[model samples]
Target chain A: MSSPKAKVLLVGMGGVGSVAAYSLEYGGKAEVTAVLRSDYQTLIDDGFEFESVDHGKVNCFRPTNITKSVEEAMEKYGPFDYAIFSLKNIPDISPIEPLIAKCYTPEVGILLLQNGIGIEKPIFKLFPEAYVMSGVTMVSSTLYGRKVVHVATEHVRVGAYDNGKIPYEKQVAKCKKFIEIYSTDKNDIIYDENVNFSRWRKLVYNACVNSSAALTDCDIGRLEVFGAMDPIVRPAMREILAIAKSDGVDLPEDVIEFMIRSDDGEWYPPSMLVDMRKGNYCEYQVILGNALDIAKENGVPAPVLSCMYHLLHVVQMKTQEKKGKFVLPEVRPLPADNFQIKYLN
Target chain B: MSSPKAKVLLVGMGGVGSVAAYSLEYGGKAEVTAVLRSDYQTLIDDGFEFESVDHGKVNCFRPTNITKSVEEAMEKYGPFDYAIFSLKNIPDISPIEPLIAKCYTPEVGILLLQNGIGIEKPIFKLFPEAYVMSGVTMVSSTLYGRKVVHVATEHVRVGAYDNGKIPYEKQVAKCKKFIEIYSTDKNDIIYDENVNFSRWRKLVYNACVNSSAALTDCDIGRLEVFGAMDPIVRPAMREILAIAKSDGVDLPEDVIEFMIRSDDGEWYPPSMLVDMRKGNYCEYQVILGNALDIAKENGVPAPVLSCMYHLLHVVQMKTQEKKGKFVLPEVRPLPADNFQIKYLN
Candidate 1:
């Protein structure tokens, strides 16, 4: 018998989600369905365009199962074998709780292609019977007008949440099939023993490099070349590592080096920096909020990251106030007196 | 005899020197001898123009004692009672060493209005017989064409070198008279017990505030509002404090607060930022070089400051190559281990 075609549903078709959907469809290993906030009529009338750095423009007219609401998505693409959750970390998880309850099944798996550490536990609590897998994408993508532009092509790694203890064989299989669809290289998928370390590794990269790049308003490539990177980047990374260690996550020194050196000496602009450039809200909460929360719980010192988060939160708050929408990410308060400021007066 | 007229020679007819010269003349404190390099012939021919942010423009001609060389300056304005050294920290000390040796008499007190710390020590070594004093000017002056514009009415603090062992009472009196001639308020000159602390304070400010601002290419006023300031600025301040402590300079905690909480609470752009904006070679050595040296001597880790210095040095080196001047600032090498890239994979 022929291998079964995996059914994948992508919620929130932003830059990342759009790219993942296109990748899944282009690779032809899965039947991809994209659920977007915009009306299906608009996207149907004007087909989606995909542009990538590695691959040229590929436009085709296929039945792009698009819907505005999750309910409509569930009705149209119900019992999805795998759901790719790549939404912004805003509006909380309350709105999605009911949807997850309705669509979640014992056999179906959920893969989170979002930033931040420990987003799976809350969802797991909401749907204890369903399997949840965590993953991080190094691919850099952005939405330029209606077209999705992939700036950087990196690999994707997904693993069973919490070390795959609760019968995640089907979920693992689904994730592997989805990875094959999304990635040009099949070896990119790494089913980790504990996905928390992988999540923390990516989080550390974003917390230090992304936050600094956003704050400085410089491209990542130029920022690394500039002198400000070390003083700004290292302390923030160290703080994130401290918080992770306290939370029982052991991040290897080599992992930190890999994250820093992974840029291939080329300046890759992080999502936060790109958002800041566009005058939009960033996922500061995903990167910094998690670290700050862990720092508070573990009682680790994180003065530099705390200050950065505070300033970024203030900026995000101002941006949200102007936008009149809760599209911006949330930031957690940092522990008090984690670090002291010394003056020469 | 008319208090010997207090003959004063000012080297470098830059914006700051021109303003100081004007202040000294208007204050009737001394006989102001303004010396300029070959490029400032226009200012000598066409009278000096002074403009204030609060007040309007005022024009005056003092027939500046312009000279092509320092030897000529000494010949024309010899046996000077005070010499204001306010040149860019380039061309090394070799150019000025002989001139100071020849012209620096026991009565001639050298006032260093340059950025950074430990500059006076080199001068002290070069001219042991002459007295050296260090001072910091909070005044903001810039040159627009032939006009010297004062953006803020900030005060200056002057102190004798080595805890006032050199009988600076006469020199202070001379400075007071010069301030009056330059139309500066009498309250601007501050004499303290230890001027070295003030120098250290300024160094800390430069290392943290200036270097970051330059690297980010943001104005001080804008940097305060920029989200990156906290991450980029605070650690730089901490690293500088660490280096200072290692160098045996005790900076009070309050000074750091004061630096952050300026009277205006707006970002205060350092001269380094201005230099970066203008695409001029910065005085990186005078600012970060000294701190790096002290940090090395004290065996303290100063990765941030060292990185900033190195980046600035590279920029300077590149500029020098383009200009074919070979005028790069001297910086102390950083600790090998501390200088290694931790995050850059």
Candidate 2:
């Protein structure tokens, strides 16, 4: 029997979302419906550019079904088989809830592609009737103008939310088919028994790596090479693990090790670091805020994480206050005079 | 009557020491003697090279009066007018204490040219007879092989230690005559009542700018353009100021402003950052360690400084350990396959 056609709706045509849409389209598993904040006329006239680290360039001319508003998207392509939500956690989720409630279909599964742990539960609560799943993508992609560049090919782990029973067999099949196009391991699609554990595992990885990288302004691989595994990663991991246990999610040691000892360990500059570097205040509330909430809820003390959260918060606040007012400070210019040194001196 | 020709012994033939020696020699104010760790043979074979930042190259050869031992230096150039010391702080000062005791002459003065604050008192305790003074050099110079390359035409600040009451007027006058050759009036050569305060001021500047630059792995000029100044410099300045105040050193507000405001008010990378890029652990102990010590001693709370110290220490220690063993862990290399978009995508 021929497989049925699947309709996929990708929200927020940012780096990861756009790449995943291309992966789905190129994999020939589904028809992608992209919801972007940019003008539809511009997208139609200019089109989107696709570039990757592995596969140099793959430009598509196919007329993309794009919309700026969820209402417009629902009106054009309703009842999507999968709604891939990769929106940033800023501006809070309240603004997006009404739209999700209006657009979500019973058959559609919401796949959350974001950093940090526990953002999916609130989304799930908003759409209790909808199939909710959480995904952790290790791939690195960035949006450049109208182009989406896939910088690195890493893994993506998707599982049921709250370890709820894997959606119907058909849903599982559709999810796997969608993931297979972009991810190397077709079998890496794990139906994790505890999605929170998986999420926490990823969070632990991010909490240790991202904050340190952002604060130190070093790359991820450089951080580990500098022995972050001991003083930084381990200390952070212990606190996250404590928080996870209080939430009744148990992260495996092997999993933590796997996160730290990845084959190609380099500075994986997190999106937050990118934002900070660009002078944009990231959604620290979503990433670190959730961690802090868990810590408070579980009565676990996360000293390092707490410190990082405060630092990021202060950074965000200061950046906001000084936005548009930032002018480069005048510094002493490099000496114009050049001196040649002969060994005899 | 005219002062007797000032006889100068410079310990540590690194960049700063060599440049200072060159300045003294070029000014024709004092007779110079360099006591390097390397033997006299190497000094004679490869004469010290001086590359000026403003002026072109100048090669001058003094007699090969170098030695591997401090005792030897004392025997050859001791009971002299002044002894200038600038050495690394690692391996502690114990190794140099005996050397200092043997070489220190009551008639001779000692001027320390090391970075950071608070190294004079211990030396004073070690050699009560000799006049101990402190100086801060602003000139940027680096040693390439046996040659010293001066990168900037900056000034130097010299002052007497502990209120200029060392009871060695002849020696102080001799030292002043030697420094007058290079330092312009733009940078004061005044003897402050508390040289430690001057040292503390310079230390505060270094701790804020240098550590952040080193940690971020960027040049000083990049910090402002990169928006790193707000996140890295602001908090570090607050902490350093707190520590300085607690140590009974009241740093002027204008000095702090001078540090934050770019020379013309533009971004500039300090030398420590340059050292980090070169993979050298330069001045961390002097910058961060001194602040840490002051904080601990004076009961000042410096969370930001503490965090930076810990982070820098880890990087330095790990780098050192890796160097000692010569076994580096495999890290993820930069993604050569991908292109980063410089602007918004």
Compared with the true structure, all predictions reach lDDT values of 0.66, 0.66
How would you encode candidate 2's per-residue C-alpha lDDT over A10-105 as one tens digit per residue?
787777776676666655667778887753555677777778775568675232477777778788887777787877766431345666786787
TM-score of chain B of 2: 0.79
TM-score of each: 0.69, 0.61
Task: Identify the CAPRI category of the predicted complex in candidate 1.
Answer: incorrect
By TM-score, the best candidate is 1
Candidate 2 DockQ score?
A: 0.17
Give per-residue lDDT, candidate 2, residue B243. Answer: 83
| lDDT of each residue in A117-233, candidate 1, tens digit only | 767777767776567878787767776657777777745778867434565675666656655656654224455656787788888888887877776565555455445456667
| DockQ of candidate 1 against the true complex | 0.10
lDDT of 1 by residue, B174-287 (tens): 555444433445326666557777778877677777776676555454455445546656667877777777766788876775676552433356778787767677778878
How many pairs of residues collide in model 1?
22
